[model samples]
Target: MFCHSMTNSMGEIMKKDKLVFKSVLLTSASFAGYNIGSGFATGVEALQFFAAWGGKFAFSGIFLALLTSMAVLIAIYVIGFEQRFVKSSDVYHYFCGKYFGIVLDYYIYVSMIFVTFTMMSGAGATISQHSGLPAFAGASIMGILCFVTAHLGLERLRKALSYLCICTVLFVLFCGGYAFLTSGVSPIAGSANSEHYVSMGLMLRANTFGIQNPYLSGLSSAGLLIVSGFAWASATGSLCNSKREAVFSGIFSSLFFYMTTAVVVYLVLTSMDHVAGTEVPMLAVVHFLLPKLSVIYSIIIILAIYSTISGRLFLIAKRYDRGNKAMGFVIILSITILAIVGASLISFSKISNVVFSIMGAVGIIVCIIVLTRFIIAETMPKQLL
Candidate 1:
């Protein structure tokens, strides 16, 4: 009897451990999936932000960006733990108070819509570039799929996104590693072949945000991610079984994001001369290094875009959902239509550059406020009693 009881206790302990591990992975993958949208999967975002700097600056910039962004992510996850049962919009209210939170909440709504439009445009661009299909067809297909997935609500969205995120990260890692190993050329070496190389100075000058400093660029990058990922992070946090799981998920997710980003930046740097002018730098790298896998990579890009689109759309629907099933459907359908139409008019590159930069500026302010609040909360005396 004593032996049987001990064995049962061990089994229960093992099961709990497995459960915690699974939660951490799901939360981590969902966070990664939300951030790895069109810009990230395509390598365009890294090209503009990190690879553009080149040399040590590129790596250092990415490191700084990850550091700051990870700090913010951890805080967001903790808030999720505290307010797990609250509505998604309540996160903003908690961080900024009722009035300012209200403003931030509405701003996030607009930002999420714009990001959805950008992802729609990205999907169209990827398909058109690879298969010569009409951009509208690609955008329409993605928009419809997003509507369906998001309508299923958070439980389904998280599982689908977690799987998609794992696939994307693995593919990117494989392709990047394969390309780098076979190229036999250092990333810095590509910079020497300056046929179409745009210097960092020129690139920064062309940026809409007027951010000349690489460090500032890092901050802006972190800001962009923090703001765009706020809703999903809060939702993921609420799903955590414990504070340990939430914190672990945040750290692991941030590290995974940084690692994949750095790999893409490395790959782009290795072929900067060729990918510099291309619409999709990662696709360009794949075509150069592994032409046979271009189709596969394109599919992955669409999936990555799909993951982000669904997450953003879910947040939008959840904002007004309030247990009204039909209303949620209407909101998602209307937004999808608007996104598809808007994406049709603008080029993907133009939308990515202008819209993301503007949002990044807003994101920076949001990060500062959140960080400040976190600092004060930690530093203040526990009690005046």
Candidate 2:
């Protein structure tokens, strides 16, 4: 009887641990979802940053960009824990000082709204591609959903995105991986062949210096990474009970994001020809792999849209008059309307060129501030650390 009691007690402890483990994964998955939204999920990010370079060179450029971005994410997440920050502005103030911090605080609204807009546009593009729906119809549907979801409050926000993130990550990995391995199309196959076979370092430099605005793509890639991950990851970090948990969650989140990107990149390269010029590239790849599941594929992308909008709205809400639900609703509605207008005005690829590239510039500014703080902290006395 005592042995039976002992076994039951052990089972309870294991069950508790399993709950914690699942909790961590769900939170991390939410962070990963932020990165895998319309931009990464739809293939616009890959097309502009990596696919434009043609074949494997695009992958190389993305590697260089992601390498720097990864460092920025890790630093920001760890510092977020150390500072015990509750908002993105707090971290900005720590690294950027007072005036700049306030400047960034305002910019956060603009930058995030812009990102939110792009997500709306991406959802539109994906749905239109999936069926014959108009882009306006698709964006409006997404905008309505996001606006409503914003009203459900934070705990529900967390739960909704957590489940959505799980679905997104699974589809991207399994579907994307399978598509890449079996797809017959490859953009690299038909490249000029002049620079097709270049070395990784040279390939990156060739693309970096090879383009009209050489710094645009690389800088934007890093910049978007900053916008997407830091605030969400930091919030996730601050929720943990201990420093170790915070750091582990942040790293795990980043790992999953990179893994999704790698799979999308591979799938894009394999079907680079079909997707390169298209608005919703990943959807194109999906259609090729599972033609009948187009609607299902689109639904998954829409689910991802919810996660992105929710995370962005969460950050935006904290900046307003202390969780003012009304103000948050106004802000979300206003942005969603604007996003619908902008999304309807152009092709997904054109928006990528204009909007995201600019965001990339913002990212560079953010990276400088974070790195400066990191440098000073490391050089300072032990007390600061």
Candidate 3:
């Protein structure tokens, strides 16, 4: 009872303390920044994921995703609290078991290479469209930034990402508010719904676009959140002052994220038909709303992409280094070469779609393990094993 009381007190303290608010905001922003990468900022990601599903599915899918996510996120946060996993490898080891954990650690190293590819692709797309530069120029610039930021160490990286994420959100809010004010069409216009609840085919084919397994949208999306949020939770949860603070941060940050996403979705839905066809959906909408300032919007897209690239590269360097300066430099150099190659090969959307789908399955498995462990720990009276 006393423990429960303390938990309640921690929750209240989180509300009253300005420092706690900053910590929670920072932690949440870090996680959000990591998860909201190139595809997300461009808005093509939402066009494919949420807007594809129409009004009702988008509505229900997002709600279910958040509901299921809170439980899984809290479970993951609790494990991180107990284990204090300071390394990316330690995070995989804890959730994936001993043998599989080793495999996953290697898998993540390989997988991050592909994500690095997508970032390069995004940077190329942005500069090519906005400044008429060669695609390689943008990719090279992003690679250099990521290379530099990786060496800044995690503490500085977190501070940097928090500021970038705050800017991204503020910019998004401004764009969303502007779009909403000027939007003549309603959000559900051309949606798969007359009204979301009254829409037919609630299960399969629920999406406005013809993306497959519309029924799995909620689960797959929830899985994506877990997979993307996993690295941050395991790698950074210890930043919170206590388990209570960690949980508080996780819950509220998620709320902040989905709330922001809801705005983006509304904006996308209002301009659904047009944004759906573009390579950079957010830029497309901004161009439509405020064409005179498209140059500034492009810069924001590049910054958003750069933020994720830097954070991912930092984690990869730390993975190899365990904080050794020489080894971290070597890993960063090798990854930079591979990312340059990735830019020459494919477009951003193609790479992001493939990477997100592959990682979604892995995220689901991690969430299941955490949920099972939470259940078992609850059933046992004496201890958490």
Candidate 4:
């Protein structure tokens, strides 16, 4: 009898552990998918923020920046779990006061729409570059797809994002790792061609919002991530079964996010000669390394773009839909139409460079507020929220 009872207890414990592990992975993948938009998928964001600094600064700078971003993400998750927020935007109100939080909320709301536009542009750029299809065709396809997935609601969206995130990360790691290993040029070694070396000053000027200082750049990047991803992160946190799950998800997701970034940065640095002046640097590198995979890589980029836009559009539609199915459909359709039109007109690089910088600057302010709140919460004897 005693032996049988012990066996039952052990089995239960194992089952519980398995469930927690599964939950952590799903949460981590969903969070990663939410953040991996066009800029990240194409390596443009990494190139501008990290690799552009040359091999020496790229690793250290990206690590620091991603660390800061990771901390911010963890804090948001913890707070979200504790509060159990109904509306995701309320996270801004919690970090900032009611008035300022309201302002930031609206700002982020509009910014999310703009980010969707950027994703549309990225989709168009990826397709046009790869297959010579009209940019609008790609944009329209992405917009429609995102709308459909998002309309499926949160439960379905979460599962879809998780699976897509896994596939995308695996693809990136394989390509980046393969490129770095196969490329004869060492990443740390400065480029032999002085003409190809992009000076820090020139890179800073060309990037517009690019911060030459690694620390500041990291903060800005963290800020941008926190601001743009606040809704999804907070929502994901609320779904956690316990604080342990939230923390685990945050740590795993953060490490995975930065690890993939480091690989891409290394790949870009080694292949700077080939990727320079290209709109999609990662695609260019993949083409140079494995020409056969370029077309497949293009589809992967679109899938990544789809994952991100679905989350953004879901949040936007949910906020305005207010439980009305017809209203939600109309909202998604209108946004898709507007995004497709905007993407058709604007260049992907311009939107990524100029608009993202401005958003990152705004995001910095939000990050400060979140950090301050987190510090205070930790110091207090009682839970503030």
Cα lDDT, all candidates: 0.83, 0.69, 0.71, 0.80
Per-residue lDDT of 313-348 in model 3, one digit per residue for the tens? 877787778667888889888998789778857876
On lDDT, the candidate that comes out on top is 1
- At residue 159, candidate 3 shows an lDDT of 82
lDDT score for residue 358 of model 2: 67
lDDT of 4 by residue, 127-226 (tens): 9988889899999999989988887777777888888888888988898778667776887663333135454222321132454465566566666677
- Off by more than 4 A, model 2: 1-23, 86-88, 184-219, 382-385
Order the numbered candidates by lDDT, best leading.
Answer: 1, 4, 3, 2
Clashes of each: 0, 2, 0, 0
TM-score of each: 0.92, 0.83, 0.86, 0.93
Give the clashing residue pairs of candidate 4, or none. Answer: none
| Deviation in Å, model 2, residue 72 alpha carbon | 1.9
lDDT of 2 by residue, 119-196 (tens): 888988887877778999998888888777766654566667777777877887887657656654554663334144
Stretches of candidate 3 exceeding 4 Å from the true structure: 1-16, 190-211, 382-384
lDDT of 1: 0.83
TM-score of model 2 vs. true structure: 0.83
What's the residue-level lDDT of 100 in candidate 2? 89
- Model 4 regions lying over 4 Å from their true place: 1-7, 190-211, 383-385
1 or 4, which is superior by lDDT? Answer: 1
1-385 per-residue lDDT for model 1 (tens digits) = 9999999999999999999999888888888888898989988788777787675567787898888888888888877886674677788887898999999999999999998998999999898888888889889999988888887678888888889989999999998779767888776776554324664322321153675566777777888888888888888888888888888877887888888999998888888777766677889888888899999999999999998999898888889888788998899999999999988888887788787788777888899899887677667885821
lDDT, candidate 3, equals 0.71
